[model samples]
Target: MSQATKTIQEINERIRKGTAVILTAEEMVDVVRAKGKSAAAREVDVVTTGTFSPMCSSGMLFNFGQEPPLIKASKVWLGNVPCHAGLAAVDAYLGCTEPSEDDPLNKVHPGRFLYGGGHVIEDLLRGKAVRLKCQAYGTDCYPRRELDKSVTLADLKSAELLNPRNCYQSYNVAVNTGSRVIYTYMGPLKPGMRNANYATAGQLSPLFNDPFLRTIGMGTKIWLGGGTGWVIGAGTQHNPKPQRNERGIPLTASGTLMLKGDMKGMSAKWVRGVSILGYGCSLSVGVGIPIPILDEEMAWFTGVSDADITMPVRDYGHDYPNGVNNVLAQPTFEELKSGEIAVNGQKVRTVPLTSYALSLEIAQELKAKIEKGEFLLTEAQDRIPSK
Candidate 1:
């Protein structure tokens, strides 16, 4: 047996009428614990989840207005970072981790990235002036060979944040078991399993709350980088078949999302550039998703707590670099959040790469918007495939 079932339309109507009962994923855990899933499903209309982490697969797509000579750009650069100009005459895409040509990469100091595409994107969005240089081979129709100009985000015809993969349901915890320290995308790892690093909001993660991809799919509305965005489709390397618990939560890296949003509506606070010592540069993005409690099962899924979310630990010094998928151990988020985790009978200090406080703020902000009728639930057009 089940409680009364609600639809996206019904939730939207309640939101519009200012009668919607919205709660953050963290809050839903307590509500479901006290009242059970069935009662919570009938009482709660929406549950908001959020995550703030560095996503290397993010980038910006820009359509720069044409110049007078109508040059067809074959090579493009924003600031010092190279941008992909294969789409159209003036359209270009800037990848987040694309290092600058003059970055002095490893020449002077190893792994110290001074600037990159991620920084350039952040500069433009912050209303700072940026230099745009293009190179083109002379043609009969378009004769201009070289062009240079200064521009800002407001000067571009269009700027869109297009991420191929983000919001990983569960990611690997990185540790170093070798002799020397190793620098990785997971940050610097000390030798002899001295420290460990992990990234995720645990129970507050968007995909973790919707573990089965039932409500989060193509055309699903989400809060991305402080702006309303959409889940375009299944992201690259979206593995939904990973090992899971009875609650459907994955124990390792699993389901991912391809997100897109307009840069004009985004905020600098949520979209920022980051430089990793001994690694490279990447973009830190904030994403939030609102789940409509359509049934009792959905409510139960959203009530999952950090104590139930587990992550696989991997040795970054050797196994991870050599493409070995060997997992050291699986630890729950509750133990990881305790500031330490036991590996090989020794207590190792643990640190989080993602910001849980900020993630909670995003969830609370999203809940407030839904309660005020500023946001509404969207019916997913298609579900992401499992295979």
Candidate 2:
């Protein structure tokens, strides 16, 4: 079957099931007159009621205003309708086509009616757009000599780059012919991970021979880079006490620290100190850059804010209880060529209004202009007020 034929069949099936029907223009105005503005605003509930009904009848049903007169058709039977039928009636009234079986729209599941509907509308009104960053540490070490306080060539070749003691050497050498001896300390370590030796005051004398060669500090820095993921240290994991900023906003140390600038891609240095047989390692200090995401307004609406009215209506599955009659009751007009009413704001579409207040106002103005002979009506049949 042609696409349009299939759509029409679907709509007819909905009507046969007794779903709510959209009001004609005249019916819309009457509903508004019966229900005051305040009560009309609450019509969303009435719409909900029809959505859950079990009878298959299609017509504009008003909640606040005088209920529309019941229409009886000799050929049409009314009573006991299924939920699908009710939904179909709504679709027919709105002149909307159901997504095909294979379409993604058909796959979407329904959520809470109000919130889901609002969210859909909001998405339609605003354009959708999403942003993503990764980072690591680097460390290095080298060796020095104990004799003559200078780096030994042999020690340099075998020295563990990560070990401080292996990388550097201390020694005493006789200078000139005098009794004085010069003490020197030397070693520029390259970056890496390795083992190092530590010398105490007494141990230094045995390793260096000269009593002048004594103990010194034992520590080294190594460059560390890429890992499985970002790591947070204990200091950050368990902050002692929360600190407040100048604005009195409390800051927690136990949060992800972002790296800054080029540091995000660059390696960091890790410093380790030798003690006993094992080495104590600490993370290298570095800065990080925070990745930017959505703009403030969009973020607030999509993320933190709680407002419901801003959400869209289409996302809610376009299930209008009152159907196309409800749409026609308001501002919608049937296009002679397409047999569909052009919706306002959106590319020709339709929406359900709780009451016909706006439509009535427009009709009244048109009547007045017509009485004043502002323009001529081409078709006398069309000039008649729609019931």
Give lDDT: candidate 1, residue 359.
Answer: 97
Candidate 2 residues lying further than 4 Å off, grouped into runs, are 1-95, 100-105, 110-354, 377-387
User: Using Cα atoms with residue i matched to residue i, what is each candidate's TM-score against the true structure?
Assistant: 0.98, 0.13
lDDT of 2 by residue, 218-255 (tens): 11011111101121111112222334323111222111
**Residue 186: error of model 1 in Å?**
0.2
lDDT of 2: 0.17
For candidate 1, list the clashing residue pairs, or say none.
Answer: none
Among the numbered candidates, top TM-score falls to: 1
